[model samples]
Target: MIGSLFSRRRPPPMTLPDPAIVVPGITATYLRDDYPLPPEVIWRVLPFQKHFGSACLHPDDLRYEAREPALIRPGPLYEVAYKELIDELRYDLSPSPEAEVPVYPFAYDWRKPLDMIEADLDAFIDEVIERTVLTRHYYKDGYDCRRTVTLIGHSMGGLIIAGFLQATGGLRTRRRRTCPDHRVSKVISLASPFRGSFEAVVKMTTGTADLGLGASSSREREAARLTPALYHLLPSFDEGLEVPAPLPRTLFDPQVWQPSILRSIETFVARTSPITRTVRKRTEALFAGLLDQARTHRERLDAFRLDQAGLGPRDWLAVVGCGADTRTRLTIAALEDGPSFVLTSDDRRNTWPNGTDTGDGTVPFLGAEPSFLDRANLVCVTPDDYGYWELEDKALTRFGGGFHGILPNMNMLHRLIVRFVTGAPDPHQKTWGRPAPGVRPDAWDPPIPGLRNKAL
Candidate 1:
């Protein structure tokens, strides 16, 4: 009688539904592709001298040997967002058994070159094809050959996806592709710096930018200088974009750098200090190489002519963050001495041809958008509604307000993402190109919350 009274009730078993589409997610920078153990161990054993230890090791050598994680370790944002998506879709779509969405998270060393990242993504695509097409996973689940896989990318990951799409001819050439197995049906990008970021310029010049790394150590600063990927993040000045003219010249041509800064870099590069000189030489070489590469990469991207990439109306969607303070326009004046420099911004210059103010925290609202997307394919979300995701029938849905890092975890955003993946209609979503009603643009705030104090 006592045992019966204390008996616990068993919950119903979960019934997983057949996989309809395979969704793969790519993450942002500063994320550890492999577990942090080996590096952490090295850091622990190394002497903690200011700039004279293994801690000062650049990312290029360190990351190449780092092992890739079996699965992406979900962050706080991913945890909340993915959980909500799974719950909502399971209940809303009543398929045989519970709906099981096959989401494969791909990991890459964020410090590596873009071409290397693209190659990793390509390999991931091949792996997915092996699982779904070659193995009959799609056919077993009633998904026909016409069904295409979906890609979701955040931050720099979005750029990686774009490059992958271009290389694989997955954009407009999906239908014309000779290989049916590697087709991508749709792409969703969040806060991608397609045009570039002024923040990157700040980091390169000042050795400051909180790229999601925990603390700003001397080593972290040095690593930023050595990482080729950071240079790639600099502003791209193609036609139709209005950025500070001096900024691009400064980045591409070493001669344009302030004389003092250039001299300091040269001195550091030539230092005979046993510990720091090697690091400095590598950093200097990285700087020169990245400038040339940035120029070449920008030209290649411009040649792609994304606006004319031939994607269908529903093939692409870009979620833009707006109504927050973002660095849209920058003015750099060389100080009286060739070595000193001053940077300035005018909030009034927030629109195209003058400034860039509209954005989440890190990406300009305009920078988040691609030249090819008309009003229909863009969604603008503001800070007030930053975490909420409302679905719409049209291709774009904008949130009134939110920070860049917080977007992935918002419940509403998760729901909307689910709807897009499942091709659900949202009657309330706004028409393409039209801003949400009564949404006022907010004053300039730092892109990442709490970063104002840290990023100088």
Candidate 2:
């Protein structure tokens, strides 16, 4: 009886599932700012009451909310883009029948610079390790069951992960010592523009292209242009033929801007005849700021490329989309007389010297393949069609069926992702052939036509 009373029962061993962090692309986080009125403000006065609507006219009256990162959860677009993956992963990685997956959707201020975002990511990872895993594990046992994390990123998110891996020395190298606690077990990058995109340059020059996201406001557009991240997404000049030397104009020169901006400036100058001193000074100042930022961006990109040389594949899987018609600018030449710009193309036919190439719409096929990755680490999946047939029939295919935006929602692609993440059979083992038009086969629902060559 005394022995039975003294004996104590030990709890069951805790088995922690490996954590997978989902790093979303740009504009995945929502930002809000709060403004507070000063205590001296009187709302009841006659003048204040009469101009109540104009109260916001004063900059001092505005109190903007501090920038905070929060996940997009309740929007219609969010439901389609991110909700499915979050739900599926939660169900797949739940530690208990009632518990959710340890996977976290990391959101950040997309308007901020990439370097600032990188710091936030590092801190977030450390916090997750300590608070979510280590804290719980230490309370029960001394060591945590899961030590490493799997990073899954899409588009710019993939670039963020790449930057993080480089900063932390996560890639395996003979000379560099890897950090044990912050080690990455596996990395899945989808449609990442490691080599940058010409589309970004087009947007910067003309401000005409849409970034897949719905119509943006003037303020949002200005913010996007000002953000250094857009500069980082400049086209990889080395992808094809080099632009002729001693170029008369480039993106760096505001004088070479498209007709719209030039026309506005010309009209202003004409209206004011000998442009007023104050107006001239303001215009010159504006142009100076734009030129300085553009020059700074180019320098930063050059430095980033030099530092990113050591990023070799350790346990990386790069998924690239192909087949769909994609816009690609091969070369840019300035008009001899003035600063007008002309873009050349590098299509297969070469029939149209300035035609677009076949890719996943937003990201070119070549740009999706990072120069640092080995051939074996890459997998190119070409969907049967751009997945917009349904909307096309309804005359609602505004964005077209490009595979870039719909990658995460593709049924076949999702299966491939799950198989790879779970360590199942090689998802790329089968040789998938493109299905003929209007002929749906049962082999792999919406067949993923494998790429003919992986050299790109």
Please provide, for model 2 over 98-205, each residue's C-alpha lDDT reduced to its tens digit, 9 standing for 90 to 100: 444467788765544465676777777666655553344332532233335667887777877776665554432222122233446667787777766666655545
lDDT of 2: 0.48
Model 1 ranges off by over 4 Å: 1-99, 134-137, 142-147, 171-182, 213-215, 237-250, 259-285, 305-310, 336-341, 344-356, 387-402, 427-456
- lDDT leader: 2
**RMSD to truth, every model:** 12.2, 10.9
State model 1's lDDT. 0.48
The estimated TM-scores of all candidates read 0.66, 0.63
